[model samples]
Target: MLKTLASYIQEYKVPSFKAMFYVTLEVIMEVLIPYLMSDLVDKGIANGNMNIILKTGLFMILASIFSLIAGALGGKYASIASCGFAKNLRKAEYKQIQDFSFSDIDLFSTGSLITRLTTDVTNIQNTYMAIIRACVRSPLMLIFALFMTFKINSKLAFVFVFAILFLSIVLYFVSTRVHPKFKKMFSKIDCMNSSVQENITGIRVVKSFVREDHEREKFSHTSDEVFSLQRKAEKLLILNSPAMQFSVYVSILLISWFGAHLIVSDSMTTGELLSMFTYTINILMSLMMLSMNIVMLTMSISSAQRIAQVINHKSTLTSPVNGATKIENGTIDFENVYFNYGHADEGYVLENFSVHIDSGSTLGVLGATGSSKSSFVQLIPRLYDVLSGSVKVAGKDVREYDLKTLRDNVAMVLQKNVLFSGTIKENMRWGNENATDEEIMEACRLAQADEFIQKMPDKYDTYIEQGGSNVSGGQRQRLCIARALLKKPKILILDDSTSAVDTKTDALIRNAFMEKIPDTTRIIISQRISSIQDADKILVIDDGKVLALGNHEELLKTCTQYKETYEAQQKGGDFDEQ
Candidate 1:
């Protein structure tokens, strides 16, 4: 994890190194000032020499000013390096997510990814700043102060060694107890974020069902879990302050008692005894800073691991070394295809699936909820690769084609229709960025979306809220269909995308597809038989296998499932009339 994170510090290395250098210089200057004061008191003040005292005091003042300047410069550079590292890490993770296949996305939850990118990255960034500044200065200051104290008087210096040992032991024990709780706290944060996001995005549903109280309870439960875990960790960490203070006070007392005896024996001067006291405080305070750095490092270790997991993960699907770049036609062939989401030990979602669609033909797919209708079309655009056999588009295996070229040729409007926050014209342009204004209007007209769009105040320029929340379900479906039509793909697959519109609008959309875009292969996956009854061919699938395949009239005569479904809808309509 350390190596992976360090790799992101590419351009910041210069500033980071400069920060460490300034910290080193600051520590050296600070350690020298107390040693100089000891000299001025002993040799100059004791002998009544004004010249010695004045010269030494001037040097001390100069050293103090330099230390202040170095410290300020170090802080500035540390902030730059750490924030730059965080920006690079977020960019790398987001770019990796863009390349992931559907199977890869399924392995991680949206909430978990959000936490890794946001809270976890911020934790690591703060830790990096602390490490560059405090971690560098603490050890250097401790070593320099220890050397100066031993030079003044070795006996008082030994007292510091014992005090440091005690503080070290306490720091280790407290950190060990706190580390696991911090790890658990971050996971609880993920849960809390997930709860908040779900409630906000689905607020309309919660209000419509009068379940506002239930959502609030759920959010409160997750929030309390995070708060409780954090409190437990903090309770352990709070012991560090009292332990450090006790060590500092005990060391000061020991130095004062021992130094007075030395002064009486004529072995140590009064000025040397005063310097011993100053060095004692410096050494112990440096240890306190080191202890705090260790605590922060411990907490950030969990966050570092989480960020590395995203940066190091390799996408399961990758473009072939020399993949095909051009598509020949709209033809699709699924030959002996078998696929599962991941576990091969479990049965495949599609087994022995075979189909051949000629260019410019219309094929309707009918299936129950879990019959894998969506999965079947997903393979064509290579959203998920087959576990065995091959799925071919335009006479080449999907895996053999360049991912961009294959997906560009085959447009899919998935089960969930999505729209970004933009004007109606802006959303339509996503399918074809270079599409002219006239081209945009023509595509909307073909999708049966122009009529409603014309009624809006802004017409084609009407602004759409995020997720197209400002539009009705049927209107959103039409707009999405129009967006896909602007792509002018060779193969267009609609996975129950028209389910929201009335029968008349649905019929009009189908007629537009048949009449306007005669040369594009159209695959319509729908529950309504009326939507696809006049298609060139229809497929009836059940339990991951094809139950029947023929034109609608031929299926009505031979396929029991098709005949029963059509009759059930007819009976429901007649009952409504009565």
Candidate 2:
């Protein structure tokens, strides 16, 4: 955890060290003020000289002013350190999300990731501020006050030292026990975040099923568990205050007793005794500050460990060392490809599969839900690597070229189409950043999206709510297709993109693909037999294996599985149920 904090600080190492230096100087100055006040009481007041009293009083005031100035400077430095750390943390976490592969994303719950990025980061930031201020200043104050006490009377200083040792043992024990509990608290928080997020995202399903009470009860259970863990941790931490006060009270009593002995012996003057008592108060107060810092240290350590777990994760997928293929007029080829979602030694998803696709031709893939149709196309962009064999684009192995070069030439429209909050044109621009107004319109027309878009309140300028919630399912599908069309890549993939649209609109969109998007290779994955009936070539897949390969008529003649699927579709596809 300490190593992680250091790495986080290293993000702004130069500025952070500068801040530490300034804070140290401020703490030193702050400790000196009480000593100056002591001098004013012992030397100035005891002398019975008005000039000495006034001069020392003025000097004490100067010390206080200097202390305040140092404190302000320290605060300025601390702000720079903490905010800079937070900015670096956000950048690193965002990069991690982008680098994660499909499998990597599947390993963690989405709401847990959100909590780590948001709430976890906040906890670290708060703890960092405490470290820069109390963590540094409190120890310095306690040490300096001890030194001043010993300078006046070593015997009384021993009383102070005894109290500190006892407090240290107590703090060490409590902090050790609470460390594991703080970590557990954060885990519980992540679980609670997941419960709340799932409820909100699936609120519609809950309402439709009339399960509001069920959901509320489920969420309440998670919340209560988190609350219970938090209470347990806080119960231990609450011991800090009384323990600290008890130590301070004992030290004060010891000091008072020693001062009384000195005054009776005339070995210490009344004014000097008064000065010792004030310094003792300062020492005890610093110890109280130290106790609070110890608790914060525990919290920060737990948070740092969680953040480090994320930062240190190695992404399974990475760009090729040599770089990606430079694609032009996309041509895709699969050569005896073998793949598995598991490790290399595990069972394969696609075994010894081989196919070739030419430029300007469309290859339609028909499959059941587990048939690896989507997985096969995902290989073209190298979303995941094949365990054995190669995927080539434009006559070169994809691994030989950089990832960006390969993706730049390909556009994939996933089955689950989603839109972010933005105008219709803004979402389209995600496909082509420099796309012209004419190009967007042409792409929309090709997608059969222009008809309904024009019907919208602002046409191309229409606002799309988050997840395109304001639009119907079919309309969202069309806009997603339009967005991909705007890219104008060499290869276009529609992974059942037309599932929500009516058969007529789906046909129009397919016709536009044939008429307007010439010279671009297309791979369409769908379960609907009619959707792929007219393709130049078609592959029927079942249980991750290709059962047949041919045009619609050829498949009906040669393949029983293909024939049965086609007959079932003619009756009414499962998509109708959806």
Candidate 3:
């Protein structure tokens, strides 16, 4: 984990080392000031000589200023290094996520990945800042001060050994007890974030269902779990302060008592005892700071591991090194395919799914809710690799083509149509960034979206609200279809994308596809039998197996399920209603 995290510190390494350098300089000056005070008291004050006193006092003043400057520089460098390192880490994690396949995304989940990127990364950033400055300075000050105290009076210094031993035991107890709680606390935090994200994104649904109170209760439960865990961890960590202060005071009191006796016996001078007190305080205070930093490091350790997990994870799918870049046609072939999500024990979402879609032909897919109709089309663009067989596009295994090349040639309008917040023209360009205004209007015309767009106040320039919330569901679906059409892909898969629009509009869009883009391989997945009755071929699948493969009239005679669905829909007369 450490190795993985440290790699993100690339360009910030110089600032990290500079922080250490300044901290070292600061510690050296801090240690020297006490020694200078000893000389001023011993040689100058004792002899009542102003010259020696002035010289030592001036040297101490210069050392104090230098130490302050070093400390400021150390703080500046630590901030730069830590913040830069965090930027690198976030950038790397985001890049890795962009390359992830659908199966890879399912592994971590959206909410969990968001928590790792934000809360976890922030924790590690603060810990890194402390490590570069306090972590470096504390041990240096502790060792240097301990050495000076021993040089002054070795017998009195043994008091510190006892005090150090005491503090070490306290640190051990606090660290061991607090670490486990901190791990649990972070888990609770992730849960809380997930709850909050879900509530905010789906607030409209919550209100529609009158479930605000339920959401509040759910969020409160997660928040209370986090608060309780944090309190417990802090309760243990709070023990460190009193233990540290107790050691500091007891050690100082012992030094003062023993040193006063040594001075009376003429074994040690008053000046040396004064310096010993100063060095003792330095040693104990630095240890206190070190203990606090150690606790923070312990807390951030789990965060670091979480971050490393994302940055180091390899996506399950990647294109071959020298993969094909050009697609010959829109033909799709699924050869003895078996696929699942996350793990195999979950059972195959689509098993032994085989199909051969001819180029420039229309194929309609029909299935019930869990028949994996969407999963079958998703394989064409290499969204998820099959477990045991190959998905081929344009006569080559999807994996054998460059990911961008394959996806660009195969446009998929998912069951849940999505439109980002932007101007209508800008969003339309998502399918083709360089698409001209005339070209965009043409695509919209084919998708039957131009009429409503022209009626809008701003027409092509109108801004789309998030998720296209400002527009009706039918309008959003039409806009998405227009955008997909702009891709001008060899293969176009509309996965129940027209479910929101009226049957008349749906028929117009299908007719437009047949007329305008005749050579494109069109795969339409729809529930409305009227939508697929005219297709060149219709496939009826159930339980991951094909029930029938023929045109509409052929399927109505051969497939009982398809015939029943069509007849039921015709009798009900409102399957097209949104």
Question: Highest lDDT among the candidates is held by which one?
Answer: 3
- Among all windows of 10 consecutive residues in model 3, the one with the lowest summed lDDT is 569-578
lDDT of 1 by residue, 37-152 (tens): 89899989999899999999999999999999999999999999999999999998898889988777778667878999998899889999988999999999998899888887
Q: Per-residue alpha-carbon lDDT of model 3 for 82-104, expressed as tens digits? A: 99999999998999999998778
RMSD of each: 2.1, 2.5, 1.6
lDDT of each: 0.90, 0.80, 0.91
What number of clashing residue pairs does each candidate have, in the order they appear? 0, 5, 0
- The Cα RMSD in angstroms, rounded to one decimal, for candidate 3 relative to the true structure is 1.6
Using TM-score as the measure, the top candidate is 3
Candidate 2 residue-wise lDDT, 367-417, digit = tens: 888888888889898888888889988888877778787777888998787
**lDDT, candidate 3, residue 24?**
98
Greater-lDDT candidate between 1 and 3: 3
Q: Please list the residue runs of candidate 2 whose C-alpha ends up more than 4 Å from where it truly belongs after superposition.
A: 1-22, 343-346, 572-578
**TM-score between candidate 2 and the true structure:** 0.94
- Better model by TM-score: candidate 2 vs candidate 3: 3
Worst 10-residue lDDT window for candidate 2 reads 10-19
On the 0 to 100 scale, the lDDT of residue 79 in model 3 is 99
